[model samples]
Target: MHSIGLIGGTFDRFHAGHHSLLLAGLEKCQKLEVWMTSDRLVQAKDSRILSWDERAAELLNFIGEDLSSSLSINSLEDNVGPAPTHSEAGAIICTSETRANCEEINLQRQKNGLGVLEIIQAEYVEAHDGKPISSSRIRAGEIDSEGNSWIPKNSRQGVITLTKEIESKLKDPFGILCEGPEDDLSVAILGALEVAGDGASPIIGVGDVTILGLQLVGINADIGLIDEKTQRQKWHGYDDINQSNFDNILNCINPPGKLTPSLLDACEIAMVNYHNDESTLIIVDGEEDLAPLFLHPLAPIGSVVLYGQPHRGVVLRLTGIDSKTRCRRLLNAFSSE
Candidate 1:
């Protein structure tokens, strides 16, 4: 009698962790049934997920022909899929986080007069920081497929400086600054929203004025980093963004010209917390001027990061490879400490 196994995941941006999980299932059962979450289901969780075809191909390539021949890969439209209902599936495989779901599936199976499945748990593949490697981290550009760090963690070593040359080159990447009358700024924000669409991507605001302006335009940011000052003057414009609005509120000291390791960790935590559809606020004690350096790499692809441009209006940066490369180049230009 062949022992059958079951495992399910979005498998977006597949990595070493996923490989470990799948191999665990293959080791325990002769035939392993893999359920890849559908695109709709993935999008319901996060817009940054890779397409279903892309995810499937990546998994197939890694698993190879021998295992692929024994594997029955199906697109999962629902959470439980066929895990609890399949008669031949005697074992279920998952990581620690998904172990509870496997047990829940067993409970449902018991109710349906089906036998309970043996739950095989796979150990998590951790990154350099010892955190479990996840697709979200990969999409954020924090880690690669094998759980290797991509962005340097020693961002707090030196102060950031915006000399005349740096300022001139970065004056306009997206467009001309929109410093303006209330109506004009509002119009500009609305136009940006039109391009981005409402609730299509996470809005990350980097400064107090930019956050307040987004609030005024009726767009509450998914993540906000503010220092309570504009043009080096004390600003109390964040009254609208009360603590009650965010699921997680963090306070970190990332001096004006430097992006600290703490700031990067905070942003990563904020992104994970924001998964519940609630907002996150990072209140900076010092300057948040250099936040783009971290945000460019930490933000999900297609998310918009908003920051003020001194006298100019808000500058919106859509997170992507180009933006991340630009941020990296600017950081390299900074005088080494």
Candidate 2:
């Protein structure tokens, strides 16, 4: 066995694939040094990517039980990390995407008058849909770390009722409540925005008031859903909100307390547009109160979903794994017909 083996990656969301890669390296070497890409590098690609400490802590927790003594996790600041210059490094484990970089490392080692290190290929893990599982895919709400989709098949095919059995759970805020007087809506909107943060992946507004407040403040959402009513009554002058501001406008008939197939279709389309860097406005013919149930699961990680609570305030939900899991569970409780 090699004295020491090296493995490096962003390792953003520790998954079965990451597990396999680490194990692959450990089998061929006495010790494995895992170099995790720094948060500074990952943020440029997806701000929703977990920080170094958060990712490292979770990774260590997973492998700490039996592999603690054989593993050493370090932050990778640059592309090659220390692989090119490290004196004691023996072999490097890499995925298909990073194989070329490993070869380049050997070239650098040759120039440094050092022997070439072995480049071992790691096992690849695929999601249920036969695609490789990736952090970007998980962040997009396509699949979980185990490669399972959060959305159950055929769940969106028909109308799903928000039954009274789960009404209390629905009423409970899934996110923080930013309370404010109705007259001065800015207080609540601004407060929620602070929590949402400027670095949030995508800001989505799911109510007429929430969309309006965002528009009036010039901080437009990547996707906005509006039913043109508030508190089960006509939001007077809802038309005053500009439709031209959005790159595309889609309409869906999502009756009060019901998630229609059309609503699901519209949301999926909006998410596609969001990926394409286009802004969308989904105008609902019925109430949009229950829309959050779908938004949390459909949105990518780091997305901020905002909706207004009549006489209360704006609710801002930072979409993440926990929120997505909760949404999936809540969706399972819906009565489909």
Candidate 3:
């Protein structure tokens, strides 16, 4: 009879590292058993594992239908899994990080009078940054399955605020200007209130009235930038806005007509949350009128940023290569402080 082998893991994203470990396990035994840890166990570790069925399908596809016949897949209810109980299993496969668990399984086997299985430890897979490949790092968006960066660190570096010396260049408008509330400007911008030109593009409302107006027109902004005031007047309904259904609410201090470091950090936090499909609100202590200073350049391509045009109405700026270039030039026009 073929010697039965055991392997246990969360197998969360099932990347190249997982493939290496499984291949090594398959080479060590004619028949291999994979114990995909239960949802509770995975949650205890990271709380964000892919569903069990998805992980199982990925493992089976990696093993191939022909080799899968000799593979036994089961849910591991506890850390020990079936390794201590499987009488005929003669080997356990794991990475160096999990080797201690294998040793504990063998100790349990000794207590139960079962034979100690050989432990096979797989080498760690390193990313382009020379860090160990892990599911948490994948979820954090540090690297892809092949360990390549989605975007280089320097490419996403934060924007620096410009000094006040070049205020002359900032007076001109960059996008189409509308002259009314959400419903009025919605028609002017050609369905921009609900979504951008692309239906799935995220809308970021950068002023108090802009956010409320978008909601008035049945368009919920993915990210809202509000300072609890309208046109420099203390808005009456701060309590109501505080009760809105935002997944996260953050505060930043940015005085009128200037982009501060705190404002940049808050914008980055909101953008990250938006990419993760979470609704976020940036509650500003001072003026949020000039938020487009950072919002236009920082938002993802295809995103739409709406800010109040004062007494005029709302202005819609589509984020793209051209828009970012214009915003950068305008920002650089200001004196570097």
Candidate 4:
């Protein structure tokens, strides 16, 4: 019914909620002017935010060339951009979070001797967990773009065994292999430290060598999984790993080639307290090698998970969409009880 409706947001990780907002504008307006936050402006909120061009491209891809004429993406320098002064903008679409700002924009428009714009509040999109889907949550690695949670709801109740059929695939490295000498693991540890420097949330260290090397270099992982073994043999220097350094010490039985519910529960507990940043150490009774398969999906996007590769050295794995998906696929391949 409106000629030109305006919608504004960062749309950084574009999720189901973003799509719904866009849909609300398209349904009521012939043309929608989407004011997206500029890269520089959004950086203060989250430095990992995609560039303006990248965000625009995602918008264009979703709206498609056929509807391109109906949609326009403008850079948002501030909360209200040209909206208060624009005589042509007849209506504005926003979420409940921004409703107050839109109301203020209308008051400013009236002050400018322009017609008051109609404000439409878009419905929220909820994730599988029944919470509102948001870019911030997506960034935290809780759910996918479609609002699907990366961690399965009923998955924490069973034991998943890495069968021989999938063992060959598991042998292949899932992340960056920082190859170095066993005697001097400085290169590999430093490599992981560099990755951690990128501001990933809740850096997880798995395996004895990986944690020991990081500890020696004074790099404390937000969460560490250790079994006091390297290459299926007990490492004599595991006593060097200071247990008191971690605030919480969790113990679970995750035998070799199998991931247990106890282990998953521990990961969930640790992650739920991510905001507090309570550093945790999970001392497994068995192998922690297979833990990464679950850790990737549970940790938020941009999370760093480090583990050793036997004679090869350390593997620096940063959890992202592709890596999380791959980890889920491998997780499904496991024979579960």
Candidate 3 TM-score over all chains jointly: 0.52
Full candidate order by TM-score, most accurate first = 4, 2, 1, 3
Who is ahead in TM-score, 1 or 4?
4
lDDT of 3: 0.73
Full-model lDDT, candidate 4: 0.84
Give Cα-based local distance difference scores for all models: 0.77, 0.87, 0.73, 0.84
Task: Give per-residue CA lDDT, model 2, range 66-100, as digits (tens).
Answer: 89789898999989899988889899999998899
How many steric overlaps are in each model, in order? 2, 0, 2, 2
Worst 10 contiguous positions by lDDT, candidate 2: 148-157
lDDT of 4 by residue, 167-255 (tens): 99878887888888889877888876675685566678998788778888887778999998888998997998888888898989888
* Ranking of candidates on lDDT, top first: 2, 4, 1, 3
Leading candidate by lDDT: 2
Tell me the tens digit of each residue's lDDT in model 3 across 1-337. Answer: 3388888888876777887887787787888888898876776675446778888997778768887887877898987777887899989999988899899889999999998999988888899889888776665444556665443232234333445555565566667676654336445334445334555456888877777766655677888999889879987645545436788888998777666767777888888898799988899888887677667666765578887776677777777546665665666554334
The regions of model 4 sitting more than 4 angstroms off are 195-200
Q: Considering every candidate listed, which one attains the maximal TM-score?
A: 4
Between 2 and 4, whose TM-score is larger?
Answer: 4
Report the C-alpha lDDT of model 1 over 215-325, residue by residue, as the tens digit. Answer: 777777889888888877887665655656667799887766556667777787787876777788898888877777777766667788777766556676677757776
Candidate 1: misplaced stretches above 4 Å? 1-4, 28-31, 40-51, 61-72, 83-91, 99-119, 135-151, 158-183, 200-202, 206-289, 300-302, 308-315, 320-335
Candidate 1 accuracy as lDDT: 0.77
